[model samples]
Target: MSFAKEVKNELTQMQTEDCCTLACSYGLLLFSRAFSVSEISLLTEHSGVASLYCDAVALLSGYVADLQETPGGYSQVSVRDRQQRINIFEKLGLPVQSPRKQINLANLQNECCFGAFLRGAFLACGTVTDPTKDYHLEFSIPSAGLCEQFIKLFDEFDLSPRTTRRNGVSVVYFKNSTDIEDILAHMGASDTYMEFIGAKVIKDIRNQVNRKCNFENANAKRAVASAGAQRDAILYIQEKRGLDSLPKQLRELAQVRLDNPELSTAALLPLLSESLTKSGLHHRMKKIEQFAEELKNRSENEN
Candidate 1:
């Protein structure tokens, strides 16, 4: 099953006896889906979600929803009777005719109610990506007013979410792993929350290892290239100016470099009879290159 479905199933297993909390959850589910005074309908692929919605409405308003199982593993639970629909709206304190569709925060009298409301809304039209692939949890709201209300609700719970549009639906989404994990935990999906945490830790460790390896590989490449350039300079100086023409210190450093051509400047340091720091070895190598450049200039002048 998808992670979203797994969370919804977990939510269904939670038992709530408070009428206000159940009504609030019913309100969120009905208003968030295709609901009206004359007709209310919810279509879902998960039987657990459909059953949860039916039970919530039944418990709150004593109205039974028509449950139908269709092909392709879909369950459709709907209230088509006008009185039943009105009963649901009235029990939840929602007016049948409103200028704008918005969540009535008055129904959410406590934290439990608030959580139940969000859980119902998720069962209605929320989805979360598998944490292994991406970090995303979103609610597909139908109206702009409802979207704004959902954002405020997130803020009230100290959750941050971003908004976007897709196919005329307003999406309130969380991309950060922490935000997603917090949401799942708030909704009482402790197991899925821990699974997300595990996935995040593994991903972070893998990325860190890859970055360290890349850094070391880059340093090794640079060291080898520098050694090659220094070798060429020393060879040119020896062939053109002769080793004896160089100053004593330069001659000794150049011979050390020639003897250990495979070694980087730092590695060549300990091999030298006279101790010098890595920087000191680099300075001597630069002087050798300078002598070689002078010889090249003299040869050009003669030509």
Candidate 2:
């Protein structure tokens, strides 16, 4: 039949993760844009493709989880799929650390349901030219907590989905460029992305350091300037003997204004909580300005 039908057929037959013929098909499609042995090498910086599925899955799942909702309750197919995926750990004879909970990845990476999952995502992508237009995330969250199990399956990198309901036929979007990029990034394929390409991790780190340093240095300078300006104004007030003394509320507002010289009255409104009304925030700033003028007059008188 069509490519989409072939994907569905493949997904039906596969149960666990390893590497699949379909994933190769999927990779070929992705690589059609640009592919290289070097890209794969860079992606597997820490380990081989076969072992990094969990980390890859977690990243991919988190991306999808952030997008859409799923069915609310459990389904036989979903349950069956999860159990089968979990069975990979068992099949590899990996130790189940606890009596009830078993199938730890470290013990049995080979047993992971990864191959099937990668294929599913790949197959889904293969059938779509436009995922957003073609499908939406439609997994249901159930009271029986199928969502939890669904997340677990999703975490295995064996599945990627989007929920869609059209003509009352609920369909999950499988793969798209966005999803594939997410998957590749999850697999440590940082070099393939714009920000993460050759200049990504180092550039990001450098930019972060620059941001922190700039903020701290600028804030420190502002704090010193504000403190000096406030002190000078206070001294001028004392010297001028204006209105006996400034009130505590007025003084605090004055200090705040100097401390945040760039702050607009509207932004200052949040700090006022119960302190002022819409107009009152502006009024308070005006009061500070008038007091500063009065201080200037007193300094002039003393001089």
Candidate 3:
């Protein structure tokens, strides 16, 4: 099953207190596909969410909602009767004719109820991407007012979410792994939360390993290029002026380069007759290249 479905299934299995059940049912209905008097419905791909919706309705209002499987393989639980819808609204303490649908804070009796309400809302209209691929959890609410209320409710729990409009629906989304983790934990999906964290940790470690490999590969390439240039300079100086003509220090370093052409400048330090720091070795090598450059310039002028 998808991670989002797994989270919803875990949430559905959770037992809530009587007061929290009311809040959860309120969240499910308010964020569902249609919750107004004309239609009280929840359309979902998850059968567990559909069953949970029906159970919540039955428990809260003593009205049994119809659960139907659509041709498109979706589970739809709905209360079509106008009286049943009104009864549900009254039971959840929602306004029958409000200007805009918004969260009823009164429905959430306590701090724990807030998490329960969010869990129900997630079951109703929320989805989370596979943590292996991406970190994203969002609630697609139909009403703009309700989306804003959801954002404020998230803020109360120290969760930050961003908002956008998609196909006339208000979407409140969290992209940061920490935010997604917090939401999952709040909803009591401890198993899915740990799975998400595991995926994130593995991804982070893989990225770090890749970066380190790239850095080492780059350093190796640079070292090879530097060694090649030094070999060329030594050969040029030997061909034009001869190694014997060079000063003793330059001559010794030149012979070392010729013999140990595969070694980087640092590696050659240990093989040198005189002890020299890396910077000291580097200075002598620079002087050798400068002499070769002077010979090349003189040859170019003569030709």
TM-score, each model? 0.87, 0.27, 0.94
Model 3 clash tally, residue pairs? 0
User: Which lDDT tens digits does candidate 1 get at residues 153-173?
Assistant: 887679878999999988989
lDDT by residue (1-303, candidate 3, tens digit) is 888878888899988798788888888888888878788889999888899899888876688999999999999998968888888878777788851356778889998898889988998889999999998999998788777778888877887789999998889998999999999998889999999999999999999999999999999999999999998998998888898878999899999988997888899999889999999999999999998899999999999
Scored by Cα lDDT, where does model 2 land? 0.39
> What are the lDDT scores of the predictions, listed in order?
0.79, 0.39, 0.88
Q: Provide the lDDT at 89 for model 1.
A: 75
User: Model 2, range 1-303, lDDT digits (tens) per residue?
Assistant: 432343234333433344333233222212121112121111111112222232223222221111112354211111123333334324334332321132222322342324433343333222322222332223222112222333354555655566544554334444444554454443332333333233334656778999999999998787566545554565566565642477766666655554566665455556642567768765655565567777678768999
Predictions: Cα RMSD each: 2.6, 18.7, 1.7
Which lDDT value does model 2 have at 230?
A: 51
The list of candidate 2 runs beyond 4 A from truth reads 1-19, 22-120, 123-182, 185-200, 203-207, 234-303
TM-score computed on alpha carbons, candidate 1: 0.87
Better of 2 and 3 by TM-score: 3
TM-score pick, better of 1 and 3:
3
- Residue 255 alpha-carbon offset, candidate 3, angstroms: 2.0
* Top TM-score model: 3
